[model samples]
Target: MPIYVQMARCCWIICFLVFSSLFRAYEASPGDSDQLYRACLSQCQKTSCVGARCFSCCNSASDGSPLDASWYNIKHLYFWWNHWDCQSNCRYHCMLYRENERAELGLEPVKYHGKWLSRRQYGFQEPISVAISALNLVMHFHGWRSFSNLIYYSLPLKPDKTPFYDYAGLFNIYGLLAMNAWFWSAAFHFREMDLTEKLEFSSFVALLGYSIILAIIRSFSLRTDAARVMVAAPIVAFATTHILFLCNYKMDYEWNTKVCIGMGIAQVASWSIWCGATEHPCRWKLRMVVVGGIFGVVVKMLDFPPYQGLVNSEVVLNASNIPLTYMWWNFIKDDAEFRTVNLLKKVR
Candidate 1:
């Protein structure tokens, strides 16, 4: 071959080899550090080989350089960005380096650093936390004072005896009245408030009031059309309103709203049966056997885990905790324990 031709062929072969090697390196998986380093070097060399036609090629190429100091710096930066520690280090490094660079260039870094900073003097507590705390307090009070024992249960009739009012029955009636009073008080308090306040107050009070009343009545009566009306009205009303509110606001506190509604409905059903039976003792045994059993099952169902998901809120509790906490004091009694036990026996 001619001397010039031979030299040109040799150059072409060298170029081909270099291009192929770089291509292979770029295609290598980044899982292995050694492989990644090699790939970076290959990419840098390939870029440099192409010359300055590629603007910003110098920075890109420098990333792969094999020089110990250059490689170490690039590797450190890569790890910093990819690892879990990046979140903490990123802000610090960006600020420090950007600041130093800006100072050197006689330019000011932007005032808004893109980092989250607290502007408000106060931090808000979560609603769920507040709710849990309130629940704990109520549970504690109920436990210590035996407030939960105030339920009513009836006995089957005996041939020579007449039905009589039991302590449980009396407590149940009183408990209903007290719950109703508190509920109405809250409703009035929030009557002039904003949408959020209205929703919170209305939802809570409605649920609680309706449930307690139902429980009171059921402990005394049996199934009847009147009982059904009383039991269903508040539940349907609350559920309808709650759904409307949710549709408008997409609030996360809807759980409590739903729970309240469900409990209200359950209590009404339970109480109506109880009351219905009380109103007609001749048919009471039969009516209680059917309606009473079903009502008991329904109330138990309301206490299940699925129902709990509806009302378990930290945010609601937190927001309403102080008021609820204070309100609970009003429900406390010196004789709460005795009353509660009596009430529980009646209900049972």
Candidate 2:
């Protein structure tokens, strides 16, 4: 085989491996599974043959667990007729015995789920985060409406020969990506399934990286299609590689966080510098967007959280998008009016 063909085959195999990793589900730790509990219950039952609490005999007075016989009894009584397996009943009784001993020693009982106060206060799902993500989706809709008007009504007003006017389709795609990112964010907060979480993170990274591409193109006045494509291609490639690495390689939270923060800083800096240097009437609106974005970034930085109510970093970022979207609408409308006026002048 030709060397190039051999390389292509290697590439295909690597791609297959990367994609295969995405389908692999995250497995919980052994303790969270029922197998160990069942095995322990079996041994306990075979030895003692208790009525409903097989592990009841496993407790010792020296361990201070004997004082919690009533606690174990409560669990045994609860699971007596529930069709629970021997292991499950034994596990429940053991849990009560442990908690009772912890109470005696004045130590907090170990949490089986996690230390997240959000789960304790609001159950599994963070409703506030979901609501904020929904609001962000609505904001994206408003942005899309403005962008649609800009494309359908305003874009056509430009001289058909202009290369810049041809970017309406690309702009529409970028807008759709933004909206879809928000949609996934909402879905993740609503259910927090593994797939949804991955989608949400991947979508957000795509949007953030693409926004940097847009900023560079728009700021440098890259009008020609080729120029825009050339400017965007590398960033898009980087974004794609980042996503593949996350799915296939180690999903290191610190590494992902640093990359995201760097991209965000670049995006904000590009827009801020452009707005500051330009003399457009909409500069103040862009400044407002910068302010809102910075506030969102600050919220993200202070993300050590109980994750309850509206205190979630994702929720605040989603809410911040509202003002930024409205400001973008006003700025785009201003630009559209400028384009319409210029077109009419040429016609006359």
Best of the candidates, TM-score: 2
lDDT by residue (tens digit), candidate 2, 28-146: 32232445334545656565433344544444467635446776677765534332334434554444444455559996434222112233113325577677777777877887787
| The 10-residue segment with the lowest total lDDT in model 2 | 112-121
| C-alpha-based local distance difference test score of model 2 | 0.61
Model 1 superposed RMSD (Cα): 29.6
Q: Give the residue spans of candidate 2 off by over 4 A.
A: 1-117, 120-124, 154-167, 307-310, 343-348
Q: Give the candidate number with the greatest lDDT.
A: 2
1-348 in candidate 1: lDDT tens per residue?
753344334433542343234322122211222343334335444453222222122333245443345555667765333322222222323333444455599963332121111111112112233334445344434432343332212233223442233333334444454444334334322221245344554544554554444444434333466865764575457556654655465442334333443444444344344444343323333343335334433443333221122232222333343443333323333233433445457867
TM-score of every model versus the real structure? 0.24, 0.63
- Give the C-alpha miss distance for residue 136 in model 1, angstroms: 5.6
